[model samples]
Target: MTLNLPQLRAFLAVVDAGGFSAAAAELGMSQSAVSHAVASLERELAAPLLIRAHPVRTTALGERVLPHARMALSAVRSVEQIAADATGTMTGTVRLAATPTVCQGLVPGLLRHWREDQPRITVRVFEGDSGEVAAWLEDGTADAAVLIDPPPAAARAFPHADPGIQLATDEYRALLPRDHPLADEPGVDLRDLEDDPLLISPNGCEDRVRTLHRRAGLRFAPTHRVRDLATLIRMVQAGIGVTVLSEVSRSLIPADLVLLPLKPQTSRRLVLTGPQTRPWHPALRTLAESAAGHLAPTTARPAEGRPLPSGTR
Candidate 1:
């Protein structure tokens, strides 16, 4: 039997949100509208796709059918991207999850490039921590995600394509005032900064923040805590204390601070996560390469020294 796309999308939403009411909120429709759509789907399918209970599930019929339903939806979305791509236009929403810096600095360029190339495509970027990114991927919200840390093994994993999952790692640097004693050395070892109040970002800042310290066999004395890179940079400019952060996008670092590499060296793991079986889209593949350029050293040019790629404003 044929089913309408709205009803199928609603059915998927109901399954994802766990109940009709929650699904209604997610869909931005009245409860009655959600109920009506689901009822219509059930009537047409002649099978109950959801069990009406807390932590709902697919009825025996649903368990057998839901998989196919999701595949069908994924296929439909894929076909849409293909058609758009063939026309030299990117269409459909590619929901992306990323840390704030990558979202702020890199994605804009990617989106700009996508728009110039595929004017019809809509890209939605969500910013959050690694945990939030993973959650978005598993629950059918985000089409893709970037993380400064490795995704939990159980989460639906969509590995980064360019460098193959483990993106390039940078030494945990101790940013010191220009004239500080440590600034003269080519690099400062973590052990040398034994008493410095190690500035740390909030737990949600990004997974890379304190990971270097973990590898350096030390714990941070977080006397100063900030939420984003800008603030962390400002704190360093003020000489409040030293901080360790991702130097992946070197251009984004402030000009006022001196970024030095750690003697022992530390690396942060970067990964891209998505549903394991989600049908691949060429746009996504392009995005992965573009993302790597933004994160890894090879593709990125020096700050303000290099112009945006061809076709990007």
Candidate 2:
């Protein structure tokens, strides 16, 4: 038997308003209609739901079912609220995930733009490696993400999805000490660093770095490995070893370190991606738009598959 919403609502209104006439007035229905609705509900349930008296009240079974009715009604209203929020006005929380470097270098500026443009929308950011970010998007832990050169395998994981917008293409740069021999060069080639100690982060860029090396007909065996980008930069500053990273990561580099564009111009694409199978929140679209605007003016798109050219920045 179907538990009708209107009947349940009528039953609740009569109890709350204390009488059939009062509930009818509250609900803008006639007293007879309200009484019939309650009676029909009790008949369908095969139980007396309410006592027909001067002051209406629930029977024992009615009391037990009241909470469930309220909850179901509340859920329906919540769905409506979500629809309302999705259509026109932008408000509420927008959760985003991104890699550490993107969060450090690019996300702050995008956040500033959002704060100025849409103060009503609150944004929460989660930082992870590229792999973790992709997983977060796939598993519904995050609403959207800034992913770096997502591979075909990862996209296949989310079939029939939007390929996402390419925010900017960034070439990897060499972080070296001021006195390093390659520090003065306009650009350093990946092959040139074959014998030199290469320091890298174990977080996300390892695979891309290796791919770049392989394309250049060289092997990438990092002599040093660090967990975070800051430490990698510090290691380079201390003259421990040279490290490579994107130009977007310029914000994290120390003042004492030099940034040289890589030779053969290796670079990766930064994409703003969201789930395709699920509804994409409007606030996330707004965030993505702001990111595109912020990145477009200052950063040039790196030629696809080009290695970093030597340059001082």
Candidate 3:
């Protein structure tokens, strides 16, 4: 069973606080946000983690699991301790696989900060498409990776609790040739490009891209299908096609292409995933937390879009 540390924390908090409202008060979040966090965790776990009494209680499964969850969370906390300058150093390499786009954006900034703080730690990066990123983790080729958050379909197949398939809470914009007709449009709908080619990562991670098109009633047939962001952006710059991208993807977009906001907004997950069964390592956990820090507030993008449209069918 996958115990998502954050979700498990929320579940434990609700249990300790006696309900969502109390948990929210203690956590400094709105009650609705607390409930949503718990529900999101339940979605990933695929089992109930709590029972609602006058004061909520852990289900037998939750009860059996809480102690371990507490232990795991505590361990996770200890691992992140090294990330704090006062906590001392973490030495060794952390092999990471990340999309070509995230590698270019988030990693660079984080590395600068990391190197200054922890001079001896080494980081080796493997760049690949989302599917390949996931493959490296599945095969133990890398310690961890950041891939697009799993879509519901992919999540159903993998069915392990982790970061749930959720859109990045960020806006997505369409990249088009500078002079393309849609450049002037403040927001373009997916159906508007029915006959045009679409470029993006192929295979399972294309879920967010395809779901956006299908929801917008757009039929995105790729004229030149490619997986790498650098290549995709080059093609779009060449006026070959348009592509959907997260804000982070813009880091790779060329000067020649224009970015347009998508009307029924869409975003993709830059999820951090690794083998759940592998024993947690200090080096690995520090890497995970460090990786998480790259997306930290100093690195966080502003929320800039409405939810994607319904009717993916």
Q: lDDT for every model? A: 0.64, 0.73, 0.63
**Residue-wise lDDT of candidate 2 within 1-313, one digit each (tens)?**
8778899778877775679998898678999999899989888999998877777777899888776765565455446446755675556556689988999998888788889887877887989887788877765556688787767665467654555656677788877888887778988887887777899888667877887788889877899899888788878888788888889898887778788888766787787766645545545655555554555644532223322111101
lDDT for each residue of candidate 3 in 1-313, tens digit (9 for 90 to 100): 4546667767767875678888887667888887887888777778888887778887878777666765676566445644643556666655677777778876676678667665666666888776788776654456567666544554455444333112134457778887888877877777786666777767443676777867877665666667666777777777677887767666666677777788677655555554444433345544545544455543332112212111110
lDDT tens digits, residue span 172-216, model 1? 566776766787888888778768766777764324545555666
Predicted structure 2: lDDT: 0.73
Highest TM-score scorer: 2
**Candidate 1: minimum summed lDDT over ten consecutive residues — where?**
302-311
Candidate 3: where is the Cα deviation over 4 Å?
1-87, 150-171, 203-205, 291-313
Clashing pairs in 3: 149-269
Model 3 deviation from native, Cα RMSD in Å: 16.8
